[model samples]
Target: MGELRLMKGNEALAEAAIRAGVDAYFGYPITPQSEVIEYLMAEKPEERTGMVVLQAESELAAINMVYGAAGAGKKVMTSSSSPGVSLKQEGLSYIAGAELPCVYANVVRGGPGLGTIQPSQADYFQSVKGGGHGDYKQIVLAPASVQEMADFVKLGFELAFQYRIAVLILSDGVIGQMMEKVELFEQMPRMSDDEIAEKYPWAVTGKKKGAERTIITSLDLDSRKMEEHNHHLQRKYAEIIDKEVRYELIQCDDAEYIIVAYGSSARIAQKTIQLAREKGIKVGLLRLITLFPFPNVQIQELCKRGIKGWLAVEMSAGQMVEDVMLAVNGNGKVAHYGRYGGIVHTPEEVLQALEEKIIGE
Candidate 1:
C-alpha cells in the first residue's frame, strides 16, 4: 500500500504524475492550477530519474513541448485552468491529428474571457467533442475528489498509450484548492527499449544510419486517403465506447428519479439523493466518470427498467442534458437543473428543484 497524506488537488495531480513515471512536464502557470507546477518544481523528480521539466513561455509553447516530447516516445503532460487551456487548443488539435500520447489536466474555472477564478464545468462540450478542430476526440476523465484527481493522472496515461491518443483529466477549481487524503504508489519503472519498440513501432524517434526516416504528419493531399483516415478514427471511437465507458450508480437499481451528474456536481447529487430519500422521494444518483464516450447505453438500459425521469445537474447551463435526452431516447422525461457562470448550486437547492419538478409535479 502507498503512504497516505493530506493533500490539495493540484499537489495530488503533480505527485501522481511523478508516481506514474512521467518523463517530463511542460506547462505555463495559471490561477488555481499553478500549484501543480509549483509542486513539481519544488519536488524535482526530474533530477532523480533524468526526467525533464520546463516552464514554457506560453500555453501555446507548453502544448507544443508536450507534442515534441510525446513524439519522442516519452510520457509527458501539462496542466492549466480553462483560459490557458483554451490557448493550448491549436497545439492540442495538432497533437490529436498526429495521434500522439500525452495527458492534459484542466483545472477548470469560469470562462469565455477570463471570466472569473472560480470553478465551473462549462467546458463539457469543448472537452468531449473536438475541443480544437477537425474530427478528433480525447479520452476525458472527470474527477470528483482529490484522490480521483491523482488517480486519473495514472489512468489517463494508460488510456493515452493504449489508444495512441491524448487523455484529459477534467477537474475544477474547488477540487484543485480543497484539501483531502491521498495515497500514491511508488513510481513505475521506465519502459525498456524492447517494450517501447513492441508498443510503438510507428514512433518518430530518429532515422538510423541506413534506415528510412518515418515522418509524422496530419496532412493528406489526397481526399480519398483523408476520408479513409477519418473513417478509421470513427471506428476507433466506436471501439472506445465499448471498452472505456465508465460510471457509478447509487441506489439507482430501484429508483424513480435519477440524477445524472459528473465531477463536483456528482458530489452535490450524492447529498441531494440522501435528502430526497429522507423525504421519501426514491431518488438515485448516476455519476459519470468517463464523460467523452458517454455512458449512453447504460442510461438507455436504466430507462428501459422503468426509470421514470432524470435530472441533469451540472455547473453549466445545459450541456450534458442533451446526452441524457438522447440516452432516454424518448422513453422517459429528462430535465436540467444547474448554476451557470461561477455560482454553484447547494445540495438543498438541488433537492428543492427535484421536489418542484420530479417528485411533486
Candidate 2:
C-alpha cells in the first residue's frame, strides 16, 4: 500500500499511469479529461519514471499514436471525451483488428454531438457495442470513484496485455472532477525490451535472427481469412465474458427491488437505495464494474431470485436498460430513469422514479 491522499479522479488517473509504468501516453485535450494530460505534463513523468507524454493535435492522431506504440509492444494509453472518442473510432477499429494491447479512458461528457461538459453515461452503447467498425470488442471498465479511476489504469493495462486487446475505462464528468481519498499503489518499472519480445513475440519490432518478420495489420485480402480472424475475435470475447464479469451486489439479500447502474449512476443509486430503505422499501443495487463483459449471468441469477422489479438508472436516455431487460428476460418489470444533456438525476429523483415507474406499478 502507498500513501493516501485526497485527489480528483483525473489526477488520480494520471498519477496511476506513472505508477503503472506506462511507456507512453499520447492524447489530445478534451473537457472533463484535459486534467489527465495536464497533470502528466506538469509531473514530467519522463524525468521521474522515463515515461513519454505527448499532446496530439487531435483525438484521431492520439489514437493512431497509441496504435503505433502498442504495435511495437510498448504500453501506451490515451484519453478523451465523447466526441473525441467518436473521432478515435477508426483508430480503435484498427487497433482491435491488429490485436494490439493498449489502454484508453473516456471521461465522458453528455453527447450526441458537442453535448455538454457535464457528466453522462450516454456512451454506454458506444463503449460496449463496438463503437468502431468491426466485429470486435474492447474490454470496458467503468470506474465509479476516484480510487477506481486510478486503479483501473493498471488493471486495464494488465487485461489489455493479458488478452492482447484494448481496454477502455469508461468514466463520467462527476467521477472525473470529484475529489476523494485514494490510496496509491507502489510504482512499477516499465517492461524491458527482452520482456516485451518474450511476451509479445508477434509485435512489430525488428526481426530476430532467422525469425519471420511480424506484421501488425487488420487488412486481409482474402474473405475466408478475414472470416477466420473474426471467429478468433469471437472466441476471445467469449473467454473474456466467462472470466472477467465484475459487479458489486449491495444489500441484495431479501430485497424486493434491484437498481442497476454503472459509473456515476451507481454512486447515485447507492444513495437511492439508502433512501428507499428508510421508507421500509426493500431495495438493492447492482453496480456494474466491467461494462463490456457485463455481469449478465449474475443479473440473471438475481432475477431468478424473484425480485419484484428493476430500475436501470443512467445519465442517458435509458441506454443500459436494454441490457437489463435482456438479462431479466421478462422475468419481472424493468424500467429506466435518466436525465440527458448533462443533467444528472439526483437521489430524490431516482427514488421518485423507482416508486412511480417500478414500485408503484
For each candidate, what TM-score against the reference?
0.97, 0.99
Q: CA lDDT, every prediction? A: 0.89, 0.94
lDDT of model number 1 = 0.89
Superposed Cα deviation of residue 350, candidate 2 (Å)? 0.4
| lDDT by residue for model 1 (182-297), tens | 98777787676566655676777766679778777788999999999889888888899999999999999779989999999999899999898998889899999999889999
Kindly list the per-residue Cα lDDT of model 2 for residues 1-361, writing each as its tens digit: 6879999999999999999999999999999999999999999999999999999999999999999999999999999999999999999999999999999999999888998999989998999999999788999999999999999999999999999999999999999999999999999999998898897887887897898989999999999999999999999999999999899999999799999999999999999999999999999999999988988889889878999899999999988999999889899999999998899899999999999999897
Highest lDDT: give the candidate number. 2
Query: Which residue pairs in model 1 clash with each other?
Result: none
TM-score of 2: 0.99
